[model samples]
Target chain A: MSAAPELNPAIEVAGLRKRYGVGDTAVDALKGVDLTVQPGEVIGLIGPSGSGKSTLLKCLGAVTEPSDGRIRLSGETVYDGGWHDLDPRALRRDRIGFVFQAPYLIPFLDVTDNVALPLLLAGRSNREARQRARELLAALDVQHRAQAAIAQLSGGEQQRVAIARALANQPPIILADEPTAPLDSERALAVVRILNRMAQQYRTAIIVVTHDEKIIPTFRRLYHIRDGRTYEEAGAGRDLG
Target chain B: MISLAGRDILHSWGKYAFTGLGLGLLIGVTLSMAGIYRGMVDDGKALLANSGADLWVVQRDTLGPYAEPSSLRDDVYRGLLGLPGVAHAANVTYLTMQARQGKREARVMVVGIQPGEPGEPRYLIAGRQIERTHYEAVADASAGFQLGQRVRIRRHDYTVVGLTRRMVSASGDPMVFIPLRDAQEAQFLKDNDAIVNERARVRANPALNRPGAPGLAETVSRSQESSRMVNAVLVQVAPGWSAAEVAETIRRWKRLQTYTVPQMEEILIAKLIATSARQIAVFLLILAVVSAAIVSFIIYTMTLGKLREIAVLKLIGARNRTIAGMILQEALGLGLIGFLVGKTVATLWAPYFPKYVLLEPGDAARGFAAVMLICALASTLAIRTALRVDPATAMGG
Candidate 1:
């Protein structure tokens, strides 16, 4: 494949550090980390337990403020030193998407409502939110079960719905933690393929955090974190088709 | 926008409905307590209405005639009738006693009324009113005395000739109407042994049984047999004259207590049943507190169960106010169901009470509003807990 033209980085971080407690009792979790990701790219994040994988994910997701860092997403500076330039909740709602280990769909809401919640929160009308959710569900190939209750769907169907929800607002970046850890090898590769197809179709960047070994070879680029720092690595790029 | 509260409730409707049913039973007890108090007041008013008298001329400086012991000479009506604006006056006496029919007995308020006067039973539901000068009685159906049944009062046996409805004393005691002479004797008569002993004591007194005074024993015996006192004089004011004016004249000139229709109503409602109203008010306060506590406990538990979901929603950009509103709406929905169930239950069981249970539409409306307000206030605790949840917990490391 030709070397793809790199667009302006969707996420750029520098000197990101986080510490818990104070004084002599303080323990550093993330020690001066730096990272970058371009739009329309799917990158894997892997680390041993307690290797600061979650801390880095929280800082990236805008859920936890870093003690000392500079974070710029889509050309907008979000965090610097001890302050955040944007509302964290609004940022999470409008620009960032999160998928979790289990498909944590709200049990009370139907599949469509679960997917449309972010769009609705972002001030879209019901019809508009529903239309967007339907398109995303159709893209994820789960449109037939959009109106079903979250509990009625199978595990795979539920995961697909969660993925649809993540792309509901067409956020430029998606952060998924342990997205395929529970699935077997075939299902795990299927999830990675779907993520790749979505990133290419929507031109969105995605960071997948996982420790599962079966699907690690599918990525072209990967980041391995050890001792609170990330190092870039080349993937196996094995063909599944 | 989708209503998170509505969707949650619909998802667990069975659980919510069962909880509401439990709360509704509590509310039903509260409403029934209120109705009981109203029944007592209504019974007092009914007693006055059934009396059919415009003025009650009682003994001097006393609130009696019904609430306390009262006595005036039976002949006082003759003097009261002579006054201007007094169209008719009748001597009436009230005595609460146990009347026996064969093997069964019931507590009844015996009203001594003169024939063809204002003190008689206003209307009958079954038989005719007392047409005889003696031995005929009219009993309220609640007293369980059937027509033609012989009921013994004191030493006399009277046949039940009439039955009335809605005639009760302030204390919910049914009433029985008898002739003035019989009622007076039944109320004040001594036993046979006591009468003999009284006669012997009179003879033993030298001033009363002088040897030269013939027929002295007989005269003394006649005095012992007669009942000269009555409870009150029931008076009717002439047309074009005010009852208050007549009552005032009697109070000033006759040196006796007089109560007009409105004044008598005050005595029955405010003075006679004041303590009962306070009792009911205290019960209402306790029930309200209990309802609030129960609602709070239920809502708090429900919110605790959904803590995980709330954290997830918060992490995904749900506002604190949105989550709080959802919890409050669920509590309010439960309260609405409870109030409807409570009101319906109270109304259905009202007629079964031994006493009248007056369920006013206005009281029910106020009760419903209060229930909703209380529920809204009670849900604040759960809402606060939910809003304080940290979105970081959803990560669940």
Candidate 2:
């Protein structure tokens, strides 16, 4: 097999716009937002409530369509001049990963299968997907609980499995929406630490949307969105020791 | 891909099993309803088969001996015997009434058949055929009659000398067969006081009591007390002739209604029991509707409870068909459970029914197919709702 090709600028968005409803009742959620992130970079997106942070994440994750935007993942155009220039669902499955505010792991599945789900959905064989899930779980320090049911796991362990699921297909980009909303200060910083380490090891770009104060200073770079617009700045880059 | 549906079911097997059991009982009732209708039709066919007649010759324009009332001269069988293709003919009478043994009584169809005649019981399960003609009767085992039991019909009591199996009327009434003369008398006989009053009234008529006709009124009064009329004449055609052809000849020569075996079957099953068949059909339709509704409601409710799980599946890039396949498989699984339980329970309870409940294998196969179809259709509502679930909702859950 040929070696996998590498792409720069893991995620790129320009003048993204999203509006809900039509006619006199329409409300603009995202207006002309522009952003970029490179491979192996972990960026923070922080803003007050109703500042278009969720709208931006939905647009990037392909969960919702943008009214007008230019989006590229791994240097390939996804949406430009129309809603779907590329197959949106296939693009999402192959190139993008998502982490929600809650772990939302399937209660019916065990911890290993929950993490292996994306690989399975991507059409990988069961043994291969499970092997990959085990490797990621070990790296995240939750491999001992691989055989446990989702409901049997602690909150931190469940969140760890969720992260493993996001990275299952080795996607070029991951969009985390309020992933630390339910965690305490220690657990929240631990989640950020894992994200940073996984980004470096896998060369995967990640964007975390958070309102938690405990882990805000951990990002070296932050993007503040206000009134559907973005302002980039630096973070405290605090040490965990 | 891993089977999401299988995993989910395994996780909650107890719940699924209990739900399936409840649905199974409803399905069992539906299958029994279908069996009851089949039994009614089988009863009609069996009633015709036991008569041992190839042709039924009755009064003109009447379907008789089983369905409608008809009366013919007792000597009509002699003339029918003379017709070509007519091997043998015998007069027969039918009267549906109560037969009492002490205080216990049973409603039965009293059939009048001569010895070695076409309308006689085909087989005896117990005891011997009637030897003494006057007060001997053969009763169906279904009527709970045993050998040597004396059953009273009208004023005279008759001994049950023989027992037959499956000897029943088209309406499922067990039969009590007696000699032709006795059945004729039992059908038309009156109380002694009423008979004496009838003779006196006839003598009082001046035209009949004329001086030149001194004995005419007496003869007329005696005639009024007796009858030589029968319900029908059962004819057996020779093996060389077609029953239809013989029936046509009889109808043309005798100027009476003639029904071949197939025609008699049509009269007994289609015309005689049409109302009962329609009632069973309505019941089957209502049961089918109720079963479908229950399945739909169950699946839809289950889907509604798992909205968050469905959203997460979709948001994680699981294809829409994957989610739909899970719901479809679950519905079909429920149906399979129901069908197995239904078939088992229907078989278990069939023999205890008051009427015969014929659970044919073919009908069970059809019932299986119907249950699967209904479950598949019932899953559509849940599938639609799951597909419409927005994947973004997981962000909140």
Candidate 3:
């Protein structure tokens, strides 16, 4: 019940590093990345292909074991030196969310099932999971299509369902990879506005990785990753209208 | 937890149904093979039951008169009837040959029995049992013969006087009953040219012609012209007499081979048709292996198609057991559909086979259990694939 501005910072990363393979063939994907974001802030991550943006996101999400780093989320130290204190799967499930460039909704499931899956996986009863999913879907203005198949929804509607799914578990941080890259300029800008509103309303910090020129200026803060390194910068933060 | 497998099946029911139907046809063939074996066993039992004889007295050390050839004297039944436990006995002959009705020849077991005796057809569906001693015959309904129809057996033509059903030999040959005298003549009667040759040879033998007696050669020729051999004696034991006792008594005192009803059945099923049973069993085994292989390949391919989805699920806190359960449930569903279709197809086509197809309820029930077990085992390959999928794959590359 805390307001977005009054909440503490949700993520802090320092000197994070990641490498693939081993010995002679190892390739360092993330060299030494450092960053932080307050709760309710919508930040942008921009970089060319193979510039280590994905590696940084993966380290932040705890999906890969970082070679060296310290990561803190919601005032808790989740990793340091050697993945200090949390089960990676539990950490990802209970503390983080994800949104992809494509909706990636399971084709077999309906909109409600796709949205409620994470909550169900977290051990919630079906009724409880469905109840939480419906609230988020309604907030995102896609509740009318709750029973529709994932394939039946339009591109924009499917993306809205994906955003609703990321919010269903009420995680402290969300990592979005090219959330609106496939949309038209107007639709892309509309998606950024929705992300900002969702962050402020839910008090969740969100990092969106994008190369879309149309929506890059919508964030107040941004990070530019190049050659396995990161640099912070300011965005336009101006209203789309 | 949400049911991943149930959702997938419901989403693509048409594809699953069509695949299940194809699998069902294969399953149907397996069931039919099993039915054919059962039918053979049933026919063996029915043949023993319909004979209405307490003991079969044949030539010493022979498996006749169904499984092998044995030629006992036609008058042996007379000596058997005077035994302590004997009530009635009759001469019976069996010959497997083609009988011509109109222009078509049907393979039949030509059974020659005494009229008004225990070895004749028990009851008739049409016409009467053979009334005339020499030229009348009683045919099984399956032989496609009608009353008063003339059927040719070898060189002789006989009128069909009666029709009966379910009277078949162990080899599935329909039975045609004729008088014992006629059958004996047809089974061993030689050609006229051979008889003529034999007569010339005999007339020319000095030991037989002996100039002292001119009629000796003619007398030997007349004896050769007549046939007198019979297959076996079908005997009915007296009231309160045991078939085993009678058979043992005949074997010991009469110095003849005798078999009780059960022993005859064993010979027919275990010895006569054992090779065929083994062949069918091998076929059933092959079909089972083929079914299992198809299930494994299908499940493995399906799991491969959902690699990304599995990774996402794993990242979102799905347990390994839940994933495995999903794959197993899908396999069970596939098996359920296949079994229903297979059972239906087997039942629908059973009667059309040339032989009886006995699809017992017990066999069907066993088949269902086997299919479920096979499906469960087959899903292990898919489960292993799903479990090996790394959750890190879901992160952007």
Best model per DockQ: 1
**Residue pairs with backbone atoms closer than 3 Å in model 3 (clashes):** none
lDDT of 2 by residue, B1-397 (tens): 8888889888888978888888888888888988988888898888778888999999988998788999899999999999999999999999999999878898899998897888899899999887777899999998877899999999999999999987778777889999999999998777799998988888898888888877998898788878799999999999799999999998888899999999998998899888988988898889888889988998899889888999988888889999999999888888998889888888999888867788989999999999999999999999999999998887662
Where is the poorest 10-residue window by lDDT in model 3 chain B? B388-397
RMSD after Cα superposition, model 3: 2.6
Candidate scoring better on lDDT of 1 and 3:
3
Report the lDDT tens digits of candidate 1 across residue range B1-397.
Answer: 7999899989999988888888888888888888888888888778888888999999887887877788999988998998999999999989999999999999999999987898888989999999898999999999999999999998889999999988888888899999999988988877789888988988888888898997798699779867899999999999999999999889888889999877888888898888988988998999999999999999999999999888878878887778988999999998988988888888888878888888878788888888999899899999999988877766654
Model 3 misplaced stretches (Cα beyond 4 Å) = A1-8, A81-87, B123-128
* Candidate 2 residue runs with Cα over 4 Å from true position: A1-7, A22-24
lDDT (0-100) at residue A239 of candidate 1? 63
Expressed as tens digits, the lDDT of each residue in B1-397 for candidate 3 is: 7788899999989978987898899889999999999998998888777778889999998999999899888878888988989998999999999999899889999998899887798988999988888889999888888899999998899999899988888888889999988998889888899899999999999999999997999999988888778888998999999999989989988899999998998999999999999999999999999999998888888888888888777766677898899899999999999999999999999988877789999999999999999999999999999998877677645
Clashes of each: 0, 0, 0
> Positional deviation of B204 in candidate 3, in angstroms?
3.2
Residue B255, candidate 2: alpha-carbon lDDT: 97
DockQ order, best first, reads 1, 3, 2
